[model samples]
Target: MSEGKTGAPHEGPFLLSQLVEWIDREHRNEPGRIIGNLLDALRRSPYYGPLVAAAEKTHRSPTERLRALPLLDRDTFYRHSPPLSNDILTGPMADAYVYASGGTTGQPKFALYSNEEYKIATDVLGFIYSTAGLEAEDVVGNIFLAGNLWTSFNVAGRALENIGCLNMPIGGATSYDMMIKFLQAFNANALVGLPSVIIKLAEEVERSGSNVRIRKILYGGEHLRAPTVEFLRRTLGCELVRSAGYACVDTGPIGYQCTHLGGSLHHVLEGYQFVEIVNPETGAVRNDGEPGEIVSTNLTRLLMPVVRYKTGDLGRWVEMDECACGFSGKTFELLGRCDDLLVIGGINLLPSDVASGLALLPVSQNFQVVARTKNSRDLLVLRLEASRPLSDAQVLEGLEHGSYKLAKAIKDGWLNVEIEWLAPGGLPRSVRTGKIKTVLDERHG
Candidate 1:
């Protein structure tokens, strides 16, 4: 998949056209039928059959039966079927494309997709790239990390090809200087990669005063906050910046951002995937505009049917009217991870909230919130890799002024707040995927 002409063998335009027609006919107008068919198919899988049978006994409707089934978390997913095993596969492994999750939070897990399924996934991505303003004439630089069983470089490279754009398969490991030279040499107008890598490249470009004028940036693998977006605009001289799309290796393409959406908002891939926002504590479905953990079911993935899988990420549905981009499907806003939540001195703190508090500061977007214990007291440390030297008073003032909950927690002495500054590249990143660990709890350690 990584080599020449990335995606499935069929012509890119034909596949994209077919997918668009399918989305309109089945996904948008008759989603219930799609879910119903998916449920019927899962009932035959050895792993999901008993669970579906149990849920079917009580619930008459497809949605009700799906809601009744247990949510599959990461631990539970691997427990039932370990990596590289056929325990969870509904079909044989022949002619299947295997990819592995980055394993940033845990050990890496592998997923299989039959050739037809792979085509569908990439074609959906190609459609999303078009929505994000990627043009067929544009030369795109693909800097997403490759190898180590990672899927981004391969999948994204393939998707770009499906868009009929000229793709420079420059993996993320290349030196920033070399990458810039390659972009210039290729006259690349758009670049796609992890947010951290893009930021680092932008910083280097700013430092070197490079004249590489990339017109668009499509990022994935991590959330790109507003400050970072602005930084990229200022540094790279890019007119358009948006998420490449919302997806994970385990679940495939889930949601996508169009030109109309910004700041964690994405339109669900209605026909390809079903999304649900559920209460983190109770697992009950959340109403639109209410925050909850994101639960997803991939409608097209029959090889390793991902049904009602807990994504561990937090988000909420955005009430839909007609979008400016003409996508009438469901939309949602992504919050931080459920696992990144920190309870300090009886106050619940989320990494997204912390990032919001520090958003206005001059610090770089890459920062970490470390929760620890000091003298039997809960301490929260904000570790920032400084763009320039900053005072403790300045950071505290920003945090207190920006977030109301954090302000109250500090005022009442429920939390002890400290600031730690480091030079660029001081913070640790996940070895496998090269993404920042947003929150770390050393309270128990």
Candidate 2:
């Protein structure tokens, strides 16, 4: 066990004040010491025993030790030859809770968390909600998708409750009329869920001419485009449409958005986890400001030690002081996932770039990027919903200048581009999570 500054074994309740103090505290550890500690703890787990055993031979120097240790990709991290059992757990299984990943990427697997780990995760989540302007007396409507093994709704509920807020667990699967009724009945001052769900609810409110007062919203589960934020702000009468946090079922809380407005960057929770950006193909760590895949080491969870686990998302490590939020910790900006990248004729493009381009145009909040291979060439289709009616010629004219950056790429023959407009409810949606399929790469399929 690690000792605190007073030399006392640092283990206690997960109080918000203490967590905030820890995050704001001025403490630094030697780089080598950090790696040593990580290696020591991970070796205790049966799942990492083989990997760490081979790594012990290269502990002569810190640089050599880190480089010698192989990167734990998802296959090696989550999939075992004989499969993991309770023996892989570092602590007693009875005292820990097991939450599962939704398996959108692959087969669902459980992540074990000790009592202390769960407390710490929820506490950090509460701090994130507080930072996003959730008041003590605010009635928060938790609309994150919830069911068997779903973590979002339960996580947000626990966090909001920890902060002494009245939480209404109106799940995302609820009907629009019922959701509206619950919001009005509880006077939900804060909303939390997927961005697409909230935007859809806002549209429903406008269509039904119902009066609902949602002061601010914290949404995640996907990227919140600037255009969607603007639409939510105007439709729901909310000033803040901030991200809930950069989190997933596999990792409880990656990071949260800073209080800074008009920025998409998330403040890194370095105190909780160690995150590094590395070249996805080479597994070599990247320098600051260089974009790469995010590999995280969970310093908090011991029951299932997730050290140097690849998260598949692409991002860059940025300086904290660059943020206007006055937060003093390293932060990062997520640039879509590694798998979400589209390679066309030796050119790389991200779906987020398409979304950003669409934001510049006077289009609706929702859109999707579809890529298909035809005649040995990549064809890019952009499906957007216009808030108001626009002729095909007018839409083409707007795209040529409204989002000149995207237009230039198309004009330069980087890829063939086509635009299609969808009616109000034309786009397909996942009813379970209330999120639109952002990318449809049919070329691979």
Candidate 3:
């Protein structure tokens, strides 16, 4: 059956819109329908009783019903990351293709994908591109990370196909020669990658004096500062397209924000997945606009049903108000990881704030904000992965300077700090998974 647009909800299970329709189709607004079904599901499903009764007594709204469920951090999810039985087949895991996720060890989240689910993810993605007014003939070069566990290249390529356009998955981590060749050979019209990666590639492309012109640049997987965006826009001679794919190995591609001209992402397909945020400390549900952990409940996938899988990330809704894009749904901006917080003298400091300060100074390409214990107290080590060559002495000196800079940038300066510079290949990649661990809590303090 014909469904809806990219920004609008589609009519199918495992899609958020379909879930909403299912709720409404059951006459959810009849005051008792929601609660009634809650009780029924509780009795029917082995995992439903406690949830249903709790909803009956406590669920104040749909959001609350979702929130009351348990919240899991990265640790808990990893425990059950690889399913051993069919009882957990709630979403696409039943008949889905499994891919490795990001991890340094051989252990990483097993990503699942169903063809039906993937199609919607692609369709919604296409609709988002259409909002940007991309024509069918637009020849776009996807600069996203590709292959095995990193699903961006494949995902974006599929979306472009669904949108009925030309796509070249040039991918990330390629040699400068290969990247230039692919873009030029394809006569690429658009570019995509991390904002920093884009900047690096743009510089290389110009320095190499390659005769190529890209029309649009889409950046994601990390924050893009306004100044950086403006620089790319001026230097690359293309409209900067800021887009993010809400997909992980565990949840697949969820929802994406349309009208990427800088606004909160519309949770386009909530029916395919259930989304919620909660205060990690109290495990209490946070109201809209409050920063909390991002969790997902997969609505599709018969192989595995993910319930309240904690993403260990934090962000907030733009506002309780409606989206200006004319789409009625929740939209949010990713703040950073939930554990990015640091406790000092019982005070908390978010690593993101520190990272932003470091970004201002062009200190490192990536970092590991590690927490360790020495003696009785805790110590914070800033192991920055430097982008350029440096001597051992120079590296030590840079660490000192970085610590001083961090102290100046953040309050409670002079906190325990150890800075190390790892060579380009020193930091291990997620063994088989494509995910990267930005920070490691080694001390458990």
Candidate 4:
């Protein structure tokens, strides 16, 4: 057992704030010590204690012990540790900060963090913001949605405070004209919000002929498409565009993209998080460059131990030494979520694959896939958000040439595909998180 600052044996309710300091001071590169300390803390939890004890009995090594534990999906996690319940907490909830999950996949559930834990998470996020090129002198406009127990705006505000940057919490609900007015008034050079929102703001800025030149954009909530990134760059005169960070309310901060890496690549927060890539179908561990589901274990969260928690996202490990960012640690490339996979005519398809098929189109990234059954046959309707009408023949040609599986399925009469065009922002979005539902399976309806 490790001793606290008072030289007493630290037992019961480990302070993650103190662990942050310990990792920074002595065990920066020691993965064994880090995992051991985290496992020690987890051993004291009511929900995890019995599981950890059993794993320890069978496995002599810490890695094996961790692997022996059960993996938690969202349903399993909530079933054992229901929202706002004290079943999984190692400490009291009086001093904790609570936030709700986006409920994009299911019902919204609450996640708690002690004051110290929140501080550590925000501090690390602030460090990542700095690594992404935010400076103390930059004026940043935060347009992330707030209120309703959401975490984005609150967390973004706190992280900006740690950076000592001039932050304007304009929020996403504010009108585009008002947001632009505030950005111009404050002389803001940087803005943070959802990719969809940012694109709309850029379009509005161009329409109004504003002189505001946003040099940096930090986006989250959804993936930014290549065409949309180019649009933002061309309209806003942006020099830097990157994801705020990869995180969720349940798991907190997981990974961040350094200045050296762009696109979907992210460096795992090795000090604060333990990440594993496992085969999505078989639950077996995957080697580097092999795509699989992402499972995470948060080392700093003792209030509610998240051990081998399945993130529902797919990714593959990248060679860490290949990046010259100086930090030698685990890195991975995100491949969207497992739930985004759609089954059409007994064939598996990903929304990302469909997007790639339509990459040459002038349409925006805001597209929806509606799967329905007509006369006992699977029918797929691709609703694309476009500024102008698109040629059906051209769009079909692109999709057919993009994927062999899709082409074969369509040609062999196994599936039927159709195209629907909608005005930009016509598709429905989740009221809670403001993200579009990519796949809508209406066969049962």
lDDT string, candidate 2, 95-124, tens digits: 766676544643566776777677778878
TM-score of 4: 0.87
Task: Say what the RMSD of model 4 is.
Answer: 4.8
lDDT of 1 by residue, 163-255 (tens): 888999999999999999999998899998998999888888888999988899999988887767788888888899988998888888889
Q: Which candidate is the best by TM-score?
A: 1
Q: For each candidate, what TM-score against the reference?
A: 0.91, 0.86, 0.72, 0.87
**What is candidate 3's lDDT per residue for 1-445, written digit by digit as tens?**
1234332233342333343354334333342443333334334433444554576577766555655666655555455445543223333345456666543455445656566556555555555555555557788877776665566677777666655667777777777678888878878888756554576666566667777777776655555544455555655677645665555556654556656336335453444556677777777667667888777765543344456777666766666455565555666677666665666423466555455445444444455677777666666776665556445445444444544544543335434665677764355445343234666777753
| Residues 234-257 of candidate 4: C-alpha lDDT, one tens digit per residue | 889999998788888888888888
Error in Å for residue 101 of model 2: 1.1
- In the order shown, what is each candidate's alpha-carbon RMSD? 3.4, 4.1, 5.7, 4.8
Clashes of 3: 29
- What's model 2's TM-score? 0.86
lDDT of 1: 0.83
Ranking 2 against 4 by lDDT, winner: 4
lDDT (Cα, 0-100) at 212 in candidate 3 = 70
Indicate the residue-level lDDT of 366 in model 2: 77
- Model 1 Cα RMSD, Å? 3.4
Point out the higher-scoring one by TM-score: 1 or 2.
1
